[model samples]
Target: MQRPDDVRWPVRVARAVLHAQATGTLIAQYGLVERAWPAALPAVPATRLGVQANCLTDVGVRGMDEAAVFLAEHLKLQGLPEAGEPVERLSAGGWAARHAAGEHSDADFCAVIDAQACFAGAWATARELVSAVLESGGPPRSPGALLYAAVVAGGEANPPVPAAELFALAGKAAAREADALLVDLRLAAYTLKRLSHPPGALGRLAGLVRGTGDAERRHALSPADAATVRALAMNLEALALLKKAAAAVRTLEDNLAENRAGHPESVGETLSIAAYFHYREQDLTRALELIAEAYRLVRRDGAPDRLRGCRKIAVAALHCGGRTAEAEQVQLRMARDPLGFDEEIR
Candidate 1:
């Protein structure tokens, strides 16, 4: 909803928060927070809903127990909880007692987990979210779960749900057709996406999906390439977080053209990711083509790290395109030792 010229503080924060989550990019707890408002501390969030949204995001990422406490008090001061009926009351003992007694399916459960996750890791919160999704009478609500998953990514994701359930439920949703597919569980995918060191739990989940090789791909890029990777990933994350997948495709298409003109090498990386969006759009042919181009560039001119990453991306693109054998080959190449190279792709 941002205009080219009218982009401001609130939009930028909103964009950054959503982008961070969508790409599974882990924003560090103490990551340098750049202010978009330029010395003005008085900046309203883009929308009224953003008031709570931004506050909740900060609480989870920074582990601001004081802020969480303040938020609870402020809600009470406003005659909330009962007044805010659906918004669960911030009663630590009461909530915790319920949680211990396995009564976490309450509608307000995700909110409670979101608040407590400010102190605790996102793993337990994720587990609770999964529980909520499993228990939903109707469909999964992707946004709320998406928000929590991204916020939780600022910390480690220990994935509280049994890996098997995560694999079964999540994999089924990923494979289903547009109509029959569970849209809400896409948030579940994002939560799992945030898992970096998915040794046992994630490894097992990867195993559930026949030969997708989705989880086998590790990040082979180096610290030197971090900025560019972050930029592209954040860009995609923003679109996904906004739930504007189709529009995101158009936006990224324009961005890819601009980047291609300015930084030719960057096209491959951006295109590789654009392929992911295309895959989401159910355009496997386009996705494979874009990824193939990226793979060519990375193999020819990419640095050692980028080559490895591009290979991994190629594998992902192929898997999404249902070209599993080709994806495996790419994975094998990615696993090979570098041929001695180092340079920024963008």
Candidate 2:
């Protein structure tokens, strides 16, 4: 929001998540999410803070805000750093809307500080407790947000923090937290593997893409998870981790195909990511197709800013495809928006 520069921490967190989810277009005007983190994060696929916030929110609701309360109390007790004044946590309905669907009854809601030592920097203790969470699970949900938090908090590295610890943390989380939207698991694993062992990660992603052809899973990723794919792919692309990025983009595209029936936002967002990847590869034909598809989705969804951004991309793609007059017409359309800011582009 506000051009990214003017935003504060949580909103900054939100912006980062949105950019990761599918560039700045998906949540350009609204449809943002922030989960509690070091403070919190908005609901965009690429946001670790959102995962963390959502994690705490999930565990809390599973136990009726008990887990979340303990986290706050644990932070206070350990004097772990936090920002902003403490605010009341959301109710279960609110959490369910943000996280995966759950059916935790009132009895499931209780405060348990058993992970206090784990959360408070007792490494062995924390790791063991996390293992217990993995072992003692019912249905899939993101229960590893706190562990991810601990790993991030513990690692302070100009020389790069010991990645083994991160691997251990993410590895465990990824196993049990199969909730698609709880992308903290995959994000952490991808970041770690992408940075340290690119080839292996690439292979793993390729397999994941191949595996999506199966019937049970069917590549039906929630919009949030797909955005996470987009975000991580962007990161990999930036690092010149081309193979891994390609795999991620493929996964994202497949996800879009499976779930595009009723969700225009996902369609528009993933199309943008796909279009950018194609544009980078100089596949102007596919890129223009993607841009046009995304523009239609954005307009159908009634998002002016998103439509404006889509038109901009169309102009670029049209110019690159040697269709200069078409690009000019798209530019003229931008000038006609209510804001009139695009008039200056002329």
Candidate 3:
């Protein structure tokens, strides 16, 4: 439950590797793992070693071949013979070779494929993998695998299956797996896409959000520790449940203010969402204040998307407050470069 850096070296290294694996940006993930790789040497847990190897393999496929080969050789030197082979194999022959070898569990294979699709943007490969699995009489049943297949089936541009049917199948699988959270959250999101503010779905989603926030508090996890609260807030916003969304945002802001959460990106996003909420409520002054703080936090890391989001909220609030010229300037700056503005809006 401690922060990644607050832990002992081994745990810190593992946490960093896991965090890298979860990161949305491949470059950032690769950098984090590359830096943590040295610290993971000699005697880390076998599980962590395997995870690091897998991560390096993923990065290598995405164009960081040197790191992958280096990690494989380093693991071999550490006498982790079992750990190095998969990296070497994956690097040399890729996921197909691994699948042919029949060594990986179905769950592991599905996870790797899912990562390829979600993180590496290999949708075609994902579809291929899913088809192969199905043809082999093994339709993905694990929650992660099912979720991935569902997303791919539903989200693609062309014809394969109806989005609604796939989502319903996924929801059922999630329910059977006792993953109440996923079922509720996934179904709520899917339903939202189909219908605007269905009362029953919104009610369920609101409860899920409240329940998750409560669970986080009970476990002493800062609402900002995971993306759960932030995601819940976004879902609420999508449902037009502003009051509940604002409550979730306040939890994130309070955790950030108390120094309980260290992720500035997450806090920045929550703030931006809150700013939009205030903007919707016609509190232009509060909207500007919140978005200014959000912009400041996001600019430190050059998060262009978050910066763009903050800019939109700030520009709207400024324009609505009779500062059209300032809004135009902000819009122009964002158009030039989302992260070019050095000064946060006041």
TM-score of 2: 0.39
TM-score of each: 0.29, 0.39, 0.52
lDDT of 1 at 193: 46
The residue-level lDDT of candidate 1 at 128 comes to 39
lDDT of 1 by residue, 1-346 (tens): 1112111222233234334434565242221122212111223234432112232333113322332332232223232111111222223334344544556433344443433332222233333344444444422333443344334433334543343333334334443222111222222233334443223323332332322222223333333233333334334343444356787688677768767756464576578667767877878778767766765565443133445655565566677768788788766655443421222211
* Model 2, residue 145: C-alpha shift (Å): 3.2
Best by TM-score: 3
The clash tally of candidate 2 reads 10
> lDDT winner among the candidates?
3
Off by over 4 Å in 2: 1-142, 147-164, 170-189, 192-198, 206-255, 261-266, 280-285, 295-313, 325-346
Candidate 3 least-lDDT 10 residues: 55-64
Which scores greater on lDDT, model 1 or model 3? 3
TM-score of 3: 0.52
Off by over 4 Å in 1: 1-243, 300-305, 320-322, 337-346
